[model samples]
Every structure is written in structure tokens, then in C-alpha cells.
Target: MVIISTENYEKIVEFCSKFKGLTIHCERQLHKKFSDIDSQVLSAILSKEWQKHIKQRHHIILKSSRIYLQEYKAQARLKGDPFILLQIAIRENFSPVSLCRILLSVEFEGKPKSVTNEMIRNPHQIPDPLLAANVLNCLLNDKSDGPITDLKRQTIGEDYEIRLKKLASDAGLNFHDEVYLRRKGYDKTPDLKLAVPCMFRGKIINWIESKASFGDMASHQQYIKDQLLSYGNRFGSGIIIYWFGYLDQIGRCPENKDCIIVTDDFPKKDELVLINNPFGPLLSSNISNITNLL
Candidate 1:
């Protein structure tokens, strides 16, 4: 975890509160006075504060909606903060991108936090609230258009689909692309679906979800709630391809009955390791088991 000095934390909160909606160049400020404070520390503090805000908002939502504690807790555990999910629960006709913009606009009261002409003039300066807000919003709402795209660029699984397609081709597996799955009356949809000829005597259709990050516990939990669990429930079985390895600190995948985690060492170009499934398999140039989830 990233650690921030108490003094710096207090300073940041105090400075930010003074101009609630103005975007201040926190990076430059830190560089000027708190030269020891790094990006990781700043990110952690911002994320923690954002999570606190979301939790507070969630309580407000529960009180207003009169939702039971048990139900709220269960839902929150699965789908992140209740306040964010509440928008979807009500069937609000807003896209993730629009919803992000709307939430930031309303939450920040349409004003930017403490940004100055000089900071704007300097391209290297990073705005604190704006950066924090964008990161928080992106974390909560995966479909939001945010800075993750810019930061990740082609590095964070942007070409995952292409790589998957190539691997499937090399394996000689018959699969479809960009398939969507939803129950007849439900609104939730899985990212991709594959027809595995070798599995279940050519009768099995497996749901596949692609994640581009080095899947840490937090990211995995979010993915489980946001995509994996729902897909597993609807489809019965699935595959999660974590291109940059599953769990940053460990090579193991979480034990799950319905899904298999595939991890790859991108830098070393080593063989892909399959985990959290019945079969302990190593995938090399022959990527056939990607279609056969045994």
C-alpha cells in the first residue's frame, strides 16, 4: 500500500477544501514543497478519500430508499457502492460515459477545484481533484470515458481481443467474436461467448471475459462483482483471461467453481498458466484448451 505523511495528507485536505470545485495542480504543489511525496502516495490518499465519499453516499442512498441493511450490504459486496448501482437499479437511461460526467458535474457542483491559469499553462502539472475524480469514476464505472484509457493506452489489454483472436486461430478453435449473452428478460450481458467443439461433445458454449490489467485482489474483486459472477451465473461456466498475470503478488488464482483464470507473462513471453480449475495445465504455442475448459 502507498503511505502518505500525515502532514501532507492534512495539507492536501485543507487546500482542497478551500476551493472545493477548483482543479489544483497537486503534483506541482507536492514537487514544490513536499518533494518526498510520490505519485503512488497521492493516488492512494485520493482513492481512500474517494472510497469514503462513496460509502457516505451509499448510506445516504440507503436511508432515502429505505433499503434494509442486509440487502444493502449484500448488494454492495457484489456490485460496489450502492449509490452508483442505484442509478442502474432504477433503470436510468444513461450510458456509463454520460453517467460519469453527470455524477462529477453534480457531485462537484459544476465547478472545478482550485485550478489556476499558470497550472493550466503548464502541461506537466497534474490537477488533484480532477485526476482523483476521474480515477475514482473510472474505477466504479468501467464503461466511463476517463484517464485510464490514456494511462493504459495499448499496454493495458487494449489489444487483448486481438491477441485472443490470434491465440484461438493458432489453436485451430472455432469461435465467434464480440458475442453478447443475456437472459430473455434480463438486461445484463457478458462480453464474449465461445462455442467449444471439444468440450461437452461440441455442445458447450463458454463465456469469456478479458481483463487487461495485472489482476490484483482488488481488481479481481471488482471484476468478480461487475462481470465474472454475473456471467458465471447466467452461463454456468466461463474463462477469465488476465493477460498480465492474475494477482500481482501471487501467481495463483482465486478458487472458483465456475470460472478458470488464465495468466500470461507478457514480458518474458513464457507459457500461459491456467489456474482455479480442475486441470493444472500449461499452455504453450498450442492454445487449444482455451476452447476446452477442462
Candidate 2:
């Protein structure tokens, strides 16, 4: 994940907002236009912008489906591109398959789900051959709610967790991962917790968290309230990895007053100064002396 300056990030976000009606095909054009940005980072930024477009225009989409649907359909029919029409009107990247549900719900006299299933599982079974043809073309390109899109996100997230854990292991650090901590009846564990604390950028880091998305201010704040602060309180200190990237001003948030260090990826082995215990030399000497006497 590349660290983007706040000004530039906002500019990219503003640029992306115009692409609400388009799909990732537009993202490809954007990459060529903004070649300096990492493609993955740009995609991550586009993903966030798309989500915002969807949320902000959700009520509008619903309204168009209910009130202005006939007008939208007339325009879609006139233009021969229902998707583009709905997209322009509602400001969302929509699937014709999902749009079929919205259309069938009204047109078929309360019989949408059955046709929706056909559109999904057996498009050939859909009665209208023209619609079936349209569906066949759009279904493969539909990244909005398709399984392929969701699975890629899930796989990326799982893979990053594995990378974080492996990095901890390669550093000769012993740590309990979330699975083990969960089994041990602990709640709110990070991705990994060190057996012995390690110094990272002068702070003793006790745990690590891995995230697969760009950390915008809203999502970052939610994570701080939900996970980061909890991990710090339970484990003393920790690092949160936003593998894709984050807002530049994220480091100055009030929640950062605690020991949660934000990073884009796992640090190399040398970056972490492994410590047997975080206690000072006096405490270590006293423990050694006590053990010797015993």
C-alpha cells in the first residue's frame, strides 16, 4: 500500500465519484490516466468511492424503482440500455440481474423471486429470450454482488492474515493468533499476539492486526472503536496493518494517543527489535536473583 498525501487522495476520490454510473472497465481507463498511482491502490480507492456512491444513492435508487420506474424504463427502452439509464439516474453501478428483480417485482404481479432465481441459476429458463440474452452478457460482467467479486475480497483478506502471521513467525517471534486466543476463551484478540513484546518504532508492540482494504477516516474510526483500542487495552500495545493503504491524516487521530501504530504492511524482521520481556533491567535482575535464590 502506498502512502498517498491527503490532498492527492481527495483529488482521486473526487475523480472517482464521476465514475459512479460505470464499472471497473472505467477503472481501467482511470489507471491509464493516473499511471503514477499503484493499480491496486487505485482499485482500493475506487472500491471505497463506489461503496459511498451506492450508500448515498440507495434511497434514490429505491425511489426510482417505485415512482420514476416507468420513466426510467421508457428512457432505457428508447436508449436500448436499461443499465446505463438506471446507473445515470441513480448514480450506482447496477446489475441487470438485480434490476430484473426490481423490474419483475412490479411487472409480474408479485412474482419476482422465482424469475430472479431463474436469472441467477438458470437464465435459459427465463421466459423472455431477449431478456435472457441481455442477462447472459451482463451476468459475467456484474461485479456488484456476484460471487466472484465477493470471493476475491474474502481471499485477499485471508491471504493478508496469513502473510502477517508468517512475518511474525519469520522474525523469531512467538505469538498466539486469533484462532488460538479464541479457543482459549479470550475475546477481542488481534491477528497475532507476541509471547514476548517487541519494540517497533520505539513502542513495545504486543499484537498485530491485518486489514485488506484502504483505511478511510470513517472505517478507521470504526476500527479504532471496535478493534484497535480493544486490542491495545487487552494486550498492552499493537500494530494495525491496512494492507491496501490509508488516509494520510489517519496517524494524527485522537485514538492514536494509545499504542496502536498504523502501517501498510508487516515490517521486516530487522525492523522489529525482539525483547524477551518489556520490563526494565532492574526488574529483570530482581527476577533472576529471585530465581537463583529459589
Candidate 3:
């Protein structure tokens, strides 16, 4: 549950920036390079910093397509990472379905177009050949406008959310997770909303949010605008867990108003105040009726 301060966080981010463009396979190299940081923490920081670079690079790619296209194609040929090509294609003019069709055609040296074209939108099964996997992975991965990076990050985020829910459950906490709350028509729901609010460390905690990435300055501010503020207004004070750690300075952001406590992990049993008296199923049914502060 380490809470990194502002100054240390900036230094960590700066150190991690050197690893931009490094792929997932570079974990071992990163571990040797970043001896001072935990492997998991280093990975998260590198992910944030690399993503920033990728975003900026993508913008430049769009603006200077004539120059970047040649560079991208060369990189794609040198490395099996076709995402470079896929991303540029998407950024250029192709919608996802169109991109799939184009890549499958003989123009791109793909399998018979008819065979692969049917499965444009995956999860809606079509006769997809095993041969199509590489291209499909690139096309799907490029949907987020990056090359093979975000899919891994998305998986990590889901894994952390599962871990958070498990820890909360093991501690005898009862709550409706984000999916359940969403189905019930709640807007701006946090990862876990306690069925019954509990006092923890002298503050009432109504909800909890899990962030799989490090909380850098920009990302934290964006979350405040898109999520934290709404969660605060609707659900009252809650906790935000930046699993890798966040800028210490973000906690003091004026908009935060001390309502959100940032932490690196789920609170321990000792840190949390479990309700001695269980409210049971009726509590859930009761809370479901309230429009705010649930």
C-alpha cells in the first residue's frame, strides 16, 4: 500500500521513459536496467510512458503519412509486428471491417479473401482459418489505434480488477461490482460499490476504483474529469487504487478535495472497518432504491 509522493513519482516516470518502444519480451532487460523499482511497478510505469509515446507518434504519423508510411512498412517487414502497418491503415482511411477485407485480399498477400472476410467482427464466429490468426491479431489489436500494446494492457487491467474483488471478498466485504451496477442502470459506478458504506480510517468509503496503470499526471487528471468527479458526486467519498503507484502530487490536486484516497493496493483488514452487524440481502435491495450516495 505504498503511496508515492509527487517528486519521487516524476523521477520514476522519467527513468522509465527510456524504455519506450520496447516490447513485452524486453521484461528481462528492463528488470536488469531498473534495479531500483519492483518488476511489476516498472512494467506499469513503462506501459504508461510508452503509451504516451505511441499516442504522440500516431498523431505525427497521421499528419505526415507520406513520410511515415514508408517507414512503417519497412518496420513491419523487418519485424513480424504487422501492427505498425495495421495502425497506419486504420489511421489513414479504413474502417475496421474494410481493413480486414483489404488485408485478406491478394493485394496484401493474404489468404483467399472470401475465407477471411466473413470473420471481420470476431466473437461473432465465421469460418476463420488458423492461417488468419496473425493478421486478425494485428487488425483487432490495432482497433485501439496502437500496435499490440493495449490488448496486453487491457488484460492486465481485467486481472487487477479480479484481484481487487477477491481481496475485498476475502475480507468479508459485500458489494456490487462495476458490471452488476452497470446492468442496474447506475452511471459513473466505481469498480466496487460497497452494498453498505463503511467507515475506514475515519472516512466513509462508499466505493472503490481500480486503475491497472500508474497514475501519471495526465492520466490522473483525465480520470478525474471522466470518472472520479462523477463517482464523487454520485456515490460520495471513495478510494482509488493505482496498482502501480501514482504521482504523489495528484493526491493534492485541488479537484480531488481529499475525498479520494489513493493507494497502491487494496486495504488490509486492519485498515478497513468491517461492519460487525451484517445487513444481509435486504441491505442490497434497500440500497438499490437510492439514486445517489449508494
Candidate 4:
């Protein structure tokens, strides 16, 4: 069956005529009427047809929402953190152009511990809280994270120490990935640093720091802030820290306005505010859980 319907057909015509050099294809079936346009006129018109098809698909999947949720759920299984799935959901809605800007303004509140237990009970429910807060934050600022991945220079120990000490030296902040830092000399730290909003290269966030129980690290809270502040931008004022688990423990950083800790460790009934970012609010969560993730 033809995916584009008569209702949206005119819109297709307008788009094709507006943009030059476009192509359209249907995976399911061939369009007998498509041949009527001829090769020369077909380019722009077909492109618009493809655009319409994609838009229609985006709306349909988003409308169902379940498909989106399922996509995230599967992603969570791989990441081992369900909340990461929520993060992924947010990413899906972003347009090609606004992605980087969206990534910059995004900062996530860590999940509470109780949330893990809650997931065990009813994993099917949409993580509306995370989605709401993230969406709101995205709208207000425009930004978006996960495991530690890589590094440029310095040893793990030296790199991590530099990152930690550097962040401490600054207002206090750091963000590091696992393989990247651990390889040099740095140990796996649970608390990702948010010392500075901007990085050394003049990038906003520097590293994704993490800490675990086994490793020898500095003071728990103070150390965390030190690492975070160090990573803060040497230029601008936006320095943020994201703690994956335990909200009350981290409470507020030296600059609560700049720091955020998200954990699913809270009571299911607890009221947590979800902030809407530019992309959309709790949209990914709804879509992932309700449609794709299922």
C-alpha cells in the first residue's frame, strides 16, 4: 500500500517544487502513478515524497510512542542503566542541525537508588520523571551522556589525577569515561566530574569522571566537587556536574545552580519535576516504552 495518502499529497507537491534535487523511495511497494511525473520532473517531486514518507513515519512512531519506548528498553539492557535509555530517547527527536546545540545545553539530574527497585517492580512504566526534567532542561538551555569512552593525552593515573586535581583547582568539576581514563592510570571513579562547564580545548564539558568502591580516591563529596570545578569552562560560567545515583547523598554541590545528580533511587510515588528541552518533553520515554521498546 502507498504510505503517503491523499490528505498529505499536496504538501508533498509543495515540498518537491520548493527544494531542488530530491529523491523518494518506498520500501513496501512500487508506485504506478510515480512514473507519470517522468524522469526530469520526478527529482524534486520524489524527494518531497520521500520527505513526506519520513515525516509520516516519524509521526506514526511518535504517535504510537510504544515503539519508541521499546527501542530504549533494548538499549537499556545493553547499557545496564535504564536511565541511559531515557537519554537515548531524547536524542532520537533531535533534528540533524540542532543536535550539537541540544547536546550543549543538556544536563541530567542523576537517578535515585529507589528507582532501580521501582524498575524491578514495574519496568514497563514510562520514566516520565527523567523525561520531563530532561525535556524542560533541553527547552530552556538546549543540550544532552553515558559510559567513559576515550582520551587525548596523559596516563590514566596522571590523566585522572590531572582531571581531578584540575577540577578541584577550578571551581571543581570533571567528566571522564571508563576505558579512556582507566587505561592511562586513572581508576574507575563513580562520580563524573562537572567542575567546569567548559573544557580545556574551550569545549563546554571536559570529561565524564566515574568512581567505584574498590578504588582509592579523594574525599567523597569535596573530591567530587573539586573534580567537577576543575572541568568547568576556563572561559564561560556554565559548569555542571551529573551524579548517576543517589540524590540526597550528593544533595547540592558548591553551586547547586550548576550541579545536578540523577538517580532512580527514590520512591516511585515521589514527585520529581521533568524539565522540557528544545527537542520535546518525556516524549522519548513515552515513545520508547509505549512503542519501540515494547
Name the candidate that leads on lDDT: 2
Q: What does candidate 4's lDDT look like per residue over 1-294, in tens digits?
A: 012233344443554434322122221112344553223223323432444444544554445455545554465456545244334434453221122122222221255544433332232332545433433332333211111111111233344445544544443233343444456565433333332232221223323443311111113355446554443332122222221122233333344234323222221211211112234343334433323211
Q: How are the candidates ranked when ordered by TM-score, highest leading?
A: 2, 3, 1, 4
Query: Compared to the true structure, candidate 3 yields what TM-score?
Result: 0.67
Model 1: lDDT equals 0.43
Pairs with steric clashes in candidate 2 = none
lDDT of 2 at 71: 57
* lDDT score for residue 276 of model 2: 50
The residue ranges of model 4 lying beyond 4 angstroms of the native Cα positions read 1-207, 214-218, 234-249, 255-257, 260-294
Compared with the true structure, model 4 gives a TM-score of 0.19
Q: Spell out the clash pairs found in candidate 1.
A: 21-112, 21-113, 22-112, 22-113, 22-114, 23-113, 23-114, 23-115
Summarize candidate 2's per-residue lDDT along 243-264 as a digit string, tens digits. Answer: 8888887877777776788889
Superposed model 1: Cα runs more than 4 Å off: 1-156, 179-191, 197-205, 248-255, 265-294
TM agreement with the true structure for every prediction: 0.38, 0.79, 0.67, 0.19
Error of 1 at 17 (Å): 24
Deviation (Å) of 111 in candidate 2:
6.9
Reference-based lDDT, each prediction: 0.43, 0.69, 0.64, 0.33
Question: Which candidate number has the best TM-score?
Answer: 2
* Tens digits of per-residue lDDT for model 1, 52-91: 4344445444343423334434655575552543344223
